[model samples]
Target: MTSLKLIFSLFIISFYSCSYVYAADLKKLAIEEFKKANYPKAIEILEHALIENNDDLELYYCLGYFTHYLCYDSVPLTGFDIRKSDEVLAYLGKAVELKPSYGDAYYFIGAEYGVRARRHLGKGEVDRAVFEFRLAREKGGLPDWLIEYGRNNLKTCDRDAILFTGGDADTNPIEYLQLVENYRRDVTVIPIALLNRPWFVQMIKYGIENAINAAPISWSREQIHDMHPYKWKTNLILIAVPETIKAELQIDKDFEWELEPDFEGRLSAGAAVLADIVKTNQWARSIYFSVACHPGMYHGLGDFFQSCGTTYRLIPTQTKDTELELDIKCIEDVFMDGDNYKSIASVADNNMPRASHMLNNYRAALFRLLIHYYKDKNKRRAKEVLDFMESTIREEYVASGALGEHLASYRKLLE
Candidate 1:
């Protein structure tokens, strides 16, 4: 009996060991397919692996991740389709069940919820959207600093302004602030990435006309859908390019350029829609771009960009110098309040690359403010800016990099 028991235990141990090894090998193969952007195949391999090694935590997580991309890719208009969310969530939920402390799993789960919330919002399901936003806040584990970042960005704009935001980090938090907290419902938040889709643009037009009663976008749905980039020949101007934009671009009778498809030869639906807004609205309402936006999103209007705290307001007045035109009063109004600077600087250190990028943006802005004060010969304000930088930002962020060198050089200048 003892011999039989020993043999059976050995057999059980060997089976599990072989299973683990097989699962690991399958994981490797799946990852390779994922790297090649063959998301469906990657998901297939993982799904099969999970049958043999049901408890593999990474396997479940990867399955969730890959399914998310596949769902996003398969969607035609916008990538916020919630139909496959259940399957993705199930895999992530299992991963979390396997390891309750799995932070990445929790983050992805929250992200999925957030995306679903956006989809609901797009579909005009406000109640469902709010519920999903709440779920995202509860499950996403977004830091307080991010919420504050969103608040600060909103503060940068005037009441009833249109704010164009970019990417998940900048856009999601602002949406949360508006939909969930009811903080800045007056300001219309438009995601540039989604503006390419007719449905999203129509939703924005409806919301602007009905909810906010802002200046109506003149383009019909069909017009917006039909819009594409075209070359700028004087006789063949498809749409009337704003004189301000024309002057900014130095377009004369002899000048020729293209709008719509950017220099990369990729048509930018967002740019097309934005141009229409600018033309139709004629600055009836304020338009600001979050500083988090890529420069390309400015759509050749960089010359008119005036830095106002956390965003750049597009003014008609052209700037001659390429240097950033700072709204000094606005910057002081936003950042100089008691504890606000500290709060801005107090973003918790994390390994998240996005969070780190945001931190760098904040730091760079602060540095620009410091330089502005220094150039103005306002020693008191300059010293205050320097003190804020030293006191608030983590040392690790500035300990030994190019930022550190810049800070060291500035400190010597201040001394």
Candidate 2:
């Protein structure tokens, strides 16, 4: 027993001597410093720790984060650019490999991918931007603030497609009719409220069976069915009604409207399983966002235009007499050219908790004000505001995925 205790004590002493010896502790201290915004001291310690132990994944990621923050700050003579995009990429790559299920590492890497996308953009690499953003969404952690921001901004065209709300009580009928039309175009609408029902489940199964037993050109129906039971069943149902129209349209597949109960979850899951679907498949980009209803005239139009470009002219002016009619028309214009009004960062920067609130109060306020400025046909103020947004987004901010790095401050406007 005495010998065993002596050996254990020796092992403990050796472990302590060989490891940290104050180095790992110092590395951790550096991370805390970085978190507290004392980057200079953090960098000093990180450099010390890295010299002693360069293979540490957390150390690399923290260093990468530090470098990224420095790049963002653009301190004079700080040589940071999208070229160093790979530095973060490499560090994150190792971090992820060292800890496969590390959510924080994934999140950081995803964020790095977003930055990579921006770098690619700066270097005129559209394909790379697309690739990085898709990967960011896949590996990036849950829908946290950073992820949501990147997702929303990076794929504005797609996500902006699905409008969540539309039409007042009076316009409900027309909207419902339109919804029916959309359903007809894609049969998933057939299931409607029955998506969650057992009957639909049976229908999907029957569809699968029928699809399988239909037989090939030369094979007997019985032979075909015998040869490929599962494949036939799965393929047939997949052709019926895919959950996202974008998915259905791209793969020539249909939805299992039966899957509506967990549609968003399915999107996230689909993003995971068919991770390459975004790059390889055109349909993945069809509807970037999947909200319930279509926004009417004054819908997401402003946001869309702000993010994209304003090549198209306004829908020809209409002589509407009533205020509600004017509002409805304006709303439609908002949806059609939503991208025109302001940079998404401008709209999103305010620390608003809920999008609904932003829509109701903040966004609405901006729209009213901008419209008011442009109402008297004050093209000059409109031009000035639009110019500021375009310049800010173009020169300052570099959005990677859904995550946008604000390059400049809009705070000056408030002042």
Candidate 3:
């Protein structure tokens, strides 16, 4: 009896060990496919892994994430059309079921609604979109990449300003501030991609109970350019413009229109609305734009907007002669390396998007900011910032492969 029991115990151990190794191998491959933007292949790998073990928590989360990415990126699945968003929701729902306490799961679910809202804006689905984002607020509060992105982007703005933006990457954290942490309670987050859609404009008006002037809800895309409608007492914040839209914008209207050709992507109705806001605002409330906003949105006013950390504070063109205050506060917040991203890199899956973003956007941005300060002749502050960066770049970032070895080389030059 003892010998038989021993054999059974060994068999069980061997089986689970093999199972774990297989799952690990599969996850690694799936992550690679995801990075390549080969969503179909990535999904196939995860689905096979699921067949091997349905209860794998990380597998479910990753499957949901990749599947959502496919639809979000407008890559239609062979049979499951991108319009069939519920399929994407189910995978995410499973992730939530497996780990209810995880705030990231909730954030992804809310993002699906944001995605769905953008698609169904014409169908008058704004209420449902608002509801899901609000639900995300209830569930999301963890300090992850998206939350940090939102916080860093908004830190430059005045308290209680309505900050307009778009994308799960950008807007989710802003919503996190309002709904979860209750930190920036009054700032209204408007996703500008949705603003490109006429129905969404009307929906925002109804859902937020804000009176948007000259919204042009009834106008067609082509007709939108003719009206000058955006007139609100509150300041206008230009959040984001899609690259495709940006490419279409006309950078400038030369005084000699006969000699100069008109550029293609001049805001049309969207740009017209911004022009009205520009005219009406008179800098009443502080007009700010996140640095992430496309340059096309500047419409010849690029010279007036100066980078202050993750955002641009609008300085009047007349002030080109006057010196502007250095935003020490923004630099301090963005570049501060109180604790490194060691814990995040150690635990994050091989292909986790947040880990890469942390390295690329936050860490790289800090490195550049260090150079900027030094070049601007603020040596003391530059050294102070460098010290904070040095603390993290070696062990937390360099020892681990989260950052390239080149960054270490860059540090040597900076010193």
Candidate 4:
């Protein structure tokens, strides 16, 4: 009986070893497919792997993550399938069950909840939307560094400003700050992509009419709901740029400029709404675009964007000859000052992919500052920026990334 039991135990060990190896190989293959944007193929590979290794934590997490990408990134190509959302939650739920301490899984789970919240909001289910938003914040498991980054971005705007955010990383954390921490409650946060939806426009209009948190919109309910892209015949005129902004950009007092639409000669729905808001708001409230936003999202107003920390404020005056200008004082005051700098400097290298993306944004901002100071021949300040980058952003993140190449070139420039 003892000899039989020993042989059985050896056989069990061999079976599990082979299963582990096979699961690892499947994960590798699925990741390769994911990297190539073959999300469906990646999901298929993971599903097949899970059939044999249902308890594999990594497999479940990958399935959840890849399904999310399929739903989000490929929506135009594959239509928004409700079934996929159910699949994502199920896979991620299994992942969490397998490992309760899985932070990445938790983050994505929060992101999925955020998506549902937006859908609920779009459907005018305010209570459900708020509930899901709160749930998203609770489940996010966001790192301190990312939260500080959101706070830093919020600090850039004046009171009652309208801030437009770009992606999940930028928008979600800011929402978390506002919802959970009660930070920057006066500022209205709008995600640019959501402007494409008529329901979102109606919602904003309702808020504006009811004197809710939204910035005032001049468009009537019908107009806002039916708003679409149109060509502008006149150049955007600016009555005056704030003197403080002028001093920051070193612009002459008499310098005046008008913004013309890009060569496309057409505005997107989001840009049209933004243009109208800028025209109607008339500097009563500051309008900002998060640094995470693409330049294309600027809607031909790129030249007027003034860098204030991690956000770009639209100023009435344009730079004379510079492609980009930084508000050095603002950066020094908000981003690199006491508590904020401490949060950034003390960020742990947790190796979270989302955290890495946020860190790259910081690195990009610092790189811009480094170039600005270097070109101005302020070697001391440039060196300070470079040192900060080296110290805060790990060498591993910079070794082969695009930022690495930029840093190498700048180091040569400094030398």
Residue-level lDDT tens digits of model 1 in 292-404: 88888877776668888678887665544434477777777776554554444434432234444665555666777898888889867887887776776656543335876
Clashes of 4: 0
Model 3 alpha-carbon drift over 4 Å, by segment:
1-84, 93-110, 115-145, 203-268, 293-302, 318-326, 337-351, 354-359, 376-380, 392-410, 413-415
Work out the TM-score per prediction: 0.80, 0.33, 0.55, 0.73
Clashing pairs in 3: 224-269, 248-265, 249-265, 249-266, 250-265, 250-266
lDDT of 1 at 84: 78
Could you tell me the lDDT of residue 354 within candidate 1?
A: 42
Overlapping backbone residue pairs in candidate 1 total: 1
lDDT of 2 by residue, 316-386 (tens): 11213312112323323433243433444443332222121212222322233344446657656545544
Better of 2 and 4 by TM-score: 4
Error of 2 at 181 (Å): 24
Q: Which stretches of candidate 2 lie over 4 Å from their true place?
A: 1-13, 32-41, 51-57, 77-79, 135-415
For candidate 2, the C-alpha RMSD (Å) to the true structure equals 20.1
Worst 10 residues of 1 by lDDT: 232-241
Of the candidates numbered 1 and 3, which has the greater lDDT value?
1
Better of 3 and 4 by TM-score: 4
Task: Flag the better candidate by lDDT, 3 or 4.
Answer: 4
